[model samples]
Target: MFTAESSFTGDFKLVPLKWAERARKSYPLESTSTAKAVNYGMYTPESMWNKCTYVISELLNECLVGSWVFAISPTAADLSTIASWISDILVDSASLVLVVLEWFQVLSAWEKTFGMPVLTRQDSEVTYSIVPAKCYWTVFAHAGASWQAKHVELVTQLREKVAIRKAAAANKQKRPEDDEDDDEVDARLHKARKRPQKNENKMQTILPTEKAKAAQQVEQPEEEEAVDICSDDSDDGYIYSDEDYSE
Candidate 1:
């Protein structure tokens, strides 16, 4: 669950989802306010192991039945039943444990995905017992038994990666260097989340168009008055009559 909590200092931090969300959000242009940066998953070293325990407990019943069936007939354990039984699964840790504990050829594909086992003593037992190192989460995380044997060195690298992811999640929650404003950061995130307006009220900018071309019209012919040759007696060199010249 994406749970939230507050400390005595009145500062609140979110959990589990926080880690995953924060890691993803840390990318460029993908960030929100870091004021509450500590909220990421509470995946501390101790808690990681405990989380694994929870995962084991949930799969405990299915693993037992499936393992036993596999011991008898490898194909007898139905994966559908395993899927229906488990709710949440993380990492391939628990499946590896059963592989190490017994060299039984069982399908751990189910565990490649779920979470926890609780510490409960047998009804007849008088005291609580600590889980053995062999039963530790690290040992389980390394459980990658397949139809074929893994090289002795390959297991070491796989376990290292599991440990690194847990550690990375744990450390990523520490207050980052950015001391950004909480309110502004929240506002920015809220703005980013909102769907863009289909019709923004912004006044459309009308771009200037090319200048219109000069218009063309027919030119009317002007009437040319006839010059009378006989009117040369006038003070002017030529005398014009109102009548126009004939073709």
Candidate 2:
């Protein structure tokens, strides 16, 4: 049995209740604040507590018997009887609490035996007990720890595969409008890419014509200058220039 005590510094401690103290008085009888904190089976009568212990013992017996029977029989255990016993235990609030606390103790014992640290708080750091490295390592690798690690890895991989399957299924279930939207996007991209090539081809076709027109304009101006030079030479060659001016 555990008793809670608060120190002057406001720290809480769980002290084991002495047999005298545990048996001195029956579970809290009054509706006081302290009494309210205690659960139904926590400080109850010895008979009630013993009943809970007996139920646990019976469960262990069932497991032992079932294991032996399973070696010879195809049906390993009487699942109905086991389930009935569990239901009977859980029906009583005190019995349920006892089972939970007992399970916690079992876990603590296993952790101690396996050199694993018992977690006491939500934010507690998990570290191994001080033991030989090789010994603990061998125990952990060979025991259920390795199997649990592999199980977690497999579960993670299964979740990833499930997510991938869901995404693929969603993609496959696309609406016709979605497909149309995708096609429209592809067409727009194709057009955008082709526009620059079309402009380049147009420039290629237009450039030679523009160059020919420019060359024609330049040659026309040069031909006009040559004709003016020829006419001036012919007038110089004519000897009636002075007589023409007098007339």
Clashes of each: 17, 0
Compute the lDDT of residue 8 as modeled in candidate 2: 15
Runs in model 1 deviating more than 4 A are: 1-162, 171-209, 213-236, 243-247
Candidate 2: tens digits of C-alpha lDDT, residues 82-124: 1101111111212121221101111243365768644342234
How much is 247 displaced in model 2, in angstroms?
22
Judge candidate 1 at residue 108 and give its lDDT: 30
TM-score of 1: 0.20
lDDT by residue for model 1 (1-247), tens? 1112211111112114444354312111112111112211212122121112222232233232122211111122231111111111222222222121111222334442353222222253422111111222333323333211232234445557767988999887745443456667988888876635322422222222211211212244567999667677868676666473552
**lDDT by candidate, in order shown:** 0.29, 0.33
Q: C-alpha displacement of 223 in model 2, angstroms?
A: 5.2
Quote each prediction's TM-score.
Answer: 0.20, 0.26
Q: How far is candidate 2 from the true structure (C-alpha RMSD, Å)?
A: 21.3
